[model samples]
Each structure stands twice: as structure tokens, then as C-alpha cells.
Target: MQKKIVKMFDEIAPSYDIVNRIVSFGSDKLWRKIAIKKSLKHLPKNPKILDVACGSGDMIEEWKKYTDNIIGLDPSQKMLEVARKRFPEIKFYQGLAQNLPFDDKSFDVISISFGIRNVVEIQKAIEEFARVLKKEGILLILEFTKPEKKSTIRNCIDFYSNKILPKIGGIISGNKEAYEYLPNSIQKFYTLNELCEKLNKKFEVIEAKNFKLSPASMIIAKKI
Candidate 1:
């Protein structure tokens, strides 16, 4: 399943960012900015940052505003190819979050946006994030969340995610199954508290803030 999903992303690499910006109505960029600011709190004067599962380097580009010593890692080579072409100066590697190809305590900050839930072994990925991070390093994760209000707006979001996102994403990306997997994965992902608990096993949870009325949240955890 993981391999299939990676290949699907490889096929959609060309239009993935375009579809993402359109589907999220440009709020994805704001989410990345907030996540970066939260992660920057623990960073050193000149921090070394790693972005895992970094689709086409959108988040990495956002991180560049704070620091230049950054590496972007993704499992899909095609996605990396696009990212490499777009940001020729930034380092990018073909890698996975579950098994990061880095030495222990190698980075000061690690960030991943909307990608952790796609990993096959979520625990292993979390462990990998902890392993590569330096002592007191910050690990930031921006992910989709289930709404707490359960109001009409929540119902509307559910309807759009389950019904409309896939249709529009498919038409734009020309990959129906890939777009379908997006909503399915988001629906099957863990909630904010659950994710915080999982991170607490390895790091200290500094903050967890929900955005867009709880449809998205960013969790910042510091390695102890």
C-alpha cells in the first residue's frame, strides 16, 4: 500500500502543489508559516533543519525564510525531482520518514506537514524523528484534525472532504485514486490529543494549536 501510494504521488508530482493550493484555498501556506514559527522557538542561532515526507518542497521553501541549512527528504523520487528542480540550492534526498537516512542527533529542528499519517509505521516514524533530532531539538508536525464543535460547519467540512475534495482533486491532478486516498488517509488519521500522547512518549509536548476551526492543527514537541 505504501509503495502504491508513493507511485501515485510520483505520477501526480507535476500538479500536486497546484491542486493543494487550490483545494486548501491558499491556507496551507499559512499553516506552514505557523508551524515554522512554532518550531523556531527551540532552534539555535543557526539551526540545521530536516523536513521529512516533504512532498514537493512547499514546506521546505517556507522554512528557508528562517534558515538556509535545511534538507528535504521524501520517499517519492519523482516528487524529489520536482522539488530539486524548483529549489536547486536546497538539499533534497529520496528517503522515508519511517527509516530516515541520517545520523543520530544530526538536526536541530525537524518539520513535517500533512505527511506523517501516510507513513505505514507511525510509531517507527516518530522514533526516527526523535533519533535524528538533537537533544532539545524541536519536532513540528502540521496535520489534519477532526473538528471538536460538531456544528453545521463541521458537517460541511466532512461533506467536502468526503465528497468534494476527491472529485476536485482528481479532476485537477488527473489521478482519481490518488486524490481519493488523500481524503481517506485524512479521515483515518489520529486526532490532536492522540498524536500528542504518541509524541509525549519520546518528546515533551510544548504546544498544540488548531487552525481553520480545528480542521487542521500543528503540534510542537521538544526532544528531552
Candidate 2:
């Protein structure tokens, strides 16, 4: 499953960014910017950042605004290649989230945006995030979430997520399965409350918000 996911990402590497803009209507950038702000709030002047599943190193670029000690890690070598090309000075590594190749307490801030659900062993990945993060380290997650049942607003978002999004994304990226799998993954993944429960085992959930009628979410936690 992991290999298949890596291959899927590798195939979509070239079109990932553009397809994301199309699917999210550019709101993805705002989501990420908000995540960065929440993660960096009250942090020290200089904080080390690690962006796991950092496709093409978008987080690396954003983190660089505050500090230069930033690294990107992902399982797809092709994605990492794009990241390397974009920011030659920023270091990037090809690795799985479940088994990060980093020392304990290596980063003061760790973030994974819109990619956590793709992880096969999601629990292990969270554990690894806790292991490598410094005590009181920030853990920020920006991800798609399944919408709540029955509200008109949520119904519209659900229609967009399960229907309109995949259609547009598939056409743009030319890897329809990749886009189709995205909405399904979010539906099958944990709810915000359930996710916070798992996170609370190793970290304290400090801030949480729902975006786009609960179809997306942001979570900022600190290592316990």
C-alpha cells in the first residue's frame, strides 16, 4: 500500500500544485498560511521545523519566512526532487512518516498538511511525530475532514468534496484515481474529535478549527 501510494504521488508530482489550486480554488494556500501562523505562535525567535509529507516543500518555503532551519521529508523521491529544485538550499529527505530518520527532539515544530491521511500506518506516524519533537514542540496538522451530517452547508461541501472536486482534480492532474482517492481517504479517516483523542496521548491539543463547513480542519498541539 505504501509503495502504491509513493508511486501514485510520483506520477502526480508534476501536476500536484496546480491541481491543488484548481480543486481548492486557491483556499489551500490560505489554509496552509493559517496553519503556519498557529504553529509559530509564541515560539522562540529561531525554531527548527520539520515538514513531514511535505509535497514539493511548500511548508519549507513558508517556514523559511520565520527561520532557515527547516527540512522536508516525504516518501516520494519525485516529489522531493521538485522540492529540491525549488529550494536548493533547503534540505529534503525521502522517508516515511511512520519511521522518520531524525534524532529525538530534533525539531521545535513539526507540520504535515493535507497528507496525513495517505499514511498507511497513521498511528505509528503520530508516535514518530511525538518522538522526534522537542518537549513542548508544536505539531500542526492541516487536513481534509469528512463533513458533519445534515446541515445544508455541510451538504454543499460534501457535494463539492465527493463530486465536484475529484472531477476537476482528475481532469487537471490526468491521474483521476489519485484525486478520486483523496475524498474517500478523508471520509474513511478519523474525525476531528477522534484525532484529538489519539493526539492527546502524546501531545496536548491547544487549538483546533474547522474550515469550509467542516470539510477541512487545522490542529495545533504541543508535545506533552
Candidate 3:
């Protein structure tokens, strides 16, 4: 799964950001803004943030408004190349989330946005997120969630994500499977209660909010 993800992301590196913006109707930036603001709430006095699966460093760039001690990590070198080009001053590393290359308690805040679903070992990845964070450090995860309402809105989202998103994403990224995997993975991903259960094993949940009509969510937890 890791190899597949690396190849897929590498293949779409050149146009991933463009497709993301288009497919999200330019709401991707807004979502990142919300994640950053949420992170700031529990950020340390001299916060050092680690952004796991920091694709194209979008979250890292948004985080700069709040802190300068930022490190972006991703498994795809192609994605890191794009991130480096965009934010030359910020640090970018090619690494996996399940096995982070950092000392214990190295960061005051950790964040992953729309990337946790791709992790081959999701629990291991969460453990790693907990390991690198300082005691009481915050972990902010922004991910796609299954909507609670099962109505016209759900049907519309399903149609858009399953049928329309892949087609448009394929045309833009030239990798239809990547886009196809997007919705499929989200559908298979854990529910909010399930995720909180997993996270609570390592950290205490401070807040959990569902957005975009519960199709998107942000979970803020602190290491105990």
C-alpha cells in the first residue's frame, strides 16, 4: 500500500495541488486555515510544529502565520520537491508517518490533513504522532468523514465523489486511480467515534468538530 501510494502521488505531483484546488472549489485553503487556527489554540509557548504527510507543504505554509518552527514530512519525494520549491525557507523531509525520524517530544504540535487515510499502518502512525509530540502537545487531524445524514445531500456527495471527482481529477492529474482511491479510501475510513476511540488510547480528546455537513472533520487531542 505504501509503495502504491508513493507511486500514485509521485505520478500526480506536478498537478496535485491544481486538481485539489479545483475539485474542492478552492475550499482546500479555507480548510487548512481552520486546521491552523485550531492548532494555535494549544500550541506551546515556543511551538515547534511537525506536519505529517505535508503534501506540497500547504499546511506548513498556513502554519507559518502562527509559528516559524515548522517541519514538513512526507513519504513522496516528488511531493517534497514541490513543497521545497514553494517554501524554500521552511524545512521539508521525505519520511513516513508510521516511523518518523525525530526524537521523542520534539514538537509542541503535530498535524496531519487528509493524509492519515493513506497510511499503511494507521495505528502505528498515530503512535508515531504521539511519540514525537511533547507532553501535553496537541495533535490536530483534519480528515474526510462519513456524513451522518443519509438523505439527498449524502446521495449528492456520493455521486460527486464517486463519479464526478475521479473523472475531473483524472483529467487534471492524469492519474484516475489516485482520485478513485480518494473517495474509496474515505468511505472505508473510520467513523468519528471510531477514530476518537483510537486516538484516546494515546491522547485525551480536547475537541472534535465535524464540518462540511459532517463530510469533513477536525480532531484535536492532547498527549496525556
Candidate 4:
């Protein structure tokens, strides 16, 4: 299953960014920006950053705004290829979140955007995040979560994600299976409180907020 997910991402890596912008209606950028800003409040100047599951290095780009000491890691070789080409000065690693190739207390901040849900062993990945981060290091997660409550806007988002996003994402990326998996993964993912509870085991939750009219949310935590 992990191999298949990596293969799917490799096939769609070239078009992933374009499809994301279209499918998210450009809100994905805002989500990352907001999360990064929140994380920065707890970080020191020029803090080292590790962007796990970075995906063409979009989140890395955001981190670059605050610091140049940044590394990107992803399981998909093709995705890392794109990221390396885009930011040749920065290092990119092809690795899984469950087992990061880094020393303990190696980074001041670690972030995973829209990629944690794809991990086959979520707890193991979270443990790895804690392991690599220094004491009081920031961990930023911007992801899609199942809605905690039913509402009119939630209904609209559900309809768009189920009925519209995959079709458009598939058309643009030319990999419909990958796009179809997006909504399904979100439905199976933890809610905001649930994910924070898991993070609380190794870190103190600083802030968590769901975007208005969107299922996307962010959690910022500090290593305990």
C-alpha cells in the first residue's frame, strides 16, 4: 500500500501543484501561510526547519521566507526531483515520515502539510517528528480533517470534495486514483481534537484552527 501511494505520487508529481491550486481554489497557500505564521511565533531566529512530506517543496518555500536552513523530505522520488529542481540550493531527501533520516534533536521546527494522513503508521510518524525535533521545537501540521460538527457550510464542502474536487484534480493531474483518494483519506483521518490529543503525548498544543468554509485545518505544537 505504501509503495502504491508512492508510485501514485510519482506519476502525478509534475501536475500536483497545479491541481492543488485549482482544487483548493488557491486556499491551500493561505492555509500554509497561516500555519507557518503561527509556528514562527514560537521559533527562534533562523531556526532550522524540516519539511516532511514536503511535496514539490511548497511548504519549504514558505519556510524559506523565515530561514534558509531548511530541508525537505518525501517518499516519492519524482516529487523530490521536482522540489530539488525548484530549490537547488536546499537539500531534499527521499524518505518516509515513519523513519526520518536525521539525528535526534536535529531540527528547530518540523512541519508536514497535507501528507500525514497518507502515512501508513501515523503514530510512528508522530514519534519520529518528536524524536528529530529539539526541546521546545515547533511542529506545524496543515492538513485536511473530518469536520467535528455538521453545518450548512460543512455540507457544501462535503459535496464539493466528494463530487467536484476529484474530477477536476483527476483531469489536471491525469491520475484520477490519486485525486479520488484525497477525500477518502480525509474522511478516514482524525478530527482536530483527536490529532491534537495524539500530539499532546510528546508536545504541547499551542494553537489549532479550522479554516472557514474549508475542511483544512492547522495545528501548531511545541516539543515538551
TM-score of each: 0.96, 0.96, 0.96, 0.98
RMSD of each: 1.3, 1.3, 1.3, 0.8
Clash counts for the predictions, in order: 0, 0, 0, 0
Tens-digit per-residue lDDT, 1-224, candidate 4: 88998899999999988998888889899888888988888989889999999989999888888889998999999999999989999988889999999999999999999999889998899899999999899899989999888899999999999989889988888778888898898998999999999887898998999989899989999989
Off by over 4 Å in 1: none
Q: Flag regions of model 4 displaced more than 4 Å.
A: none
lDDT of 4: 0.91
lDDT of 1 by residue, 104-176 (tens): 9999998988888778898999999999999999999998875544778778877887888889998988888
Candidate 2 Cα misplacement greater than 4 A, ranges: none
> What's the residue-level lDDT of 125 in candidate 1?
92
lDDT of 2 by residue, 1-224 (tens): 89998899999999988887777778877888888877777467789889999999887778888888998999998899899999999988889999999999998989998888889898899999999998899999988876545588987877887888888888888878998888778879877877788788899999988886447898999999
The window of 10 residues in a row where model 4 has the poorest summed lDDT is 170-179
The TM-score between candidate 1 and the true structure equals 0.96
lDDT winner between candidates 1 and 2: 1
Task: In model 2, state the lDDT of residue 107.
Answer: 87
What C-alpha lDDT do the candidate models reach, one value each? 0.86, 0.86, 0.87, 0.91
| Sliding window of 10 residues with minimal summed lDDT for model 3 | 207-216
Give lDDT tens digits, candidate 3, residues 114-211.
88888989899989988999899999999987765567877887889999999999998888999999889888888777888898789999988877
Clash pairs, model 1 backbone: none
Q: Predictions ranked by lDDT, top down?
A: 4, 3, 1, 2
Model 3 RMSD to the real structure?
A: 1.3
- Cα lDDT for residue 181, model 2? 88
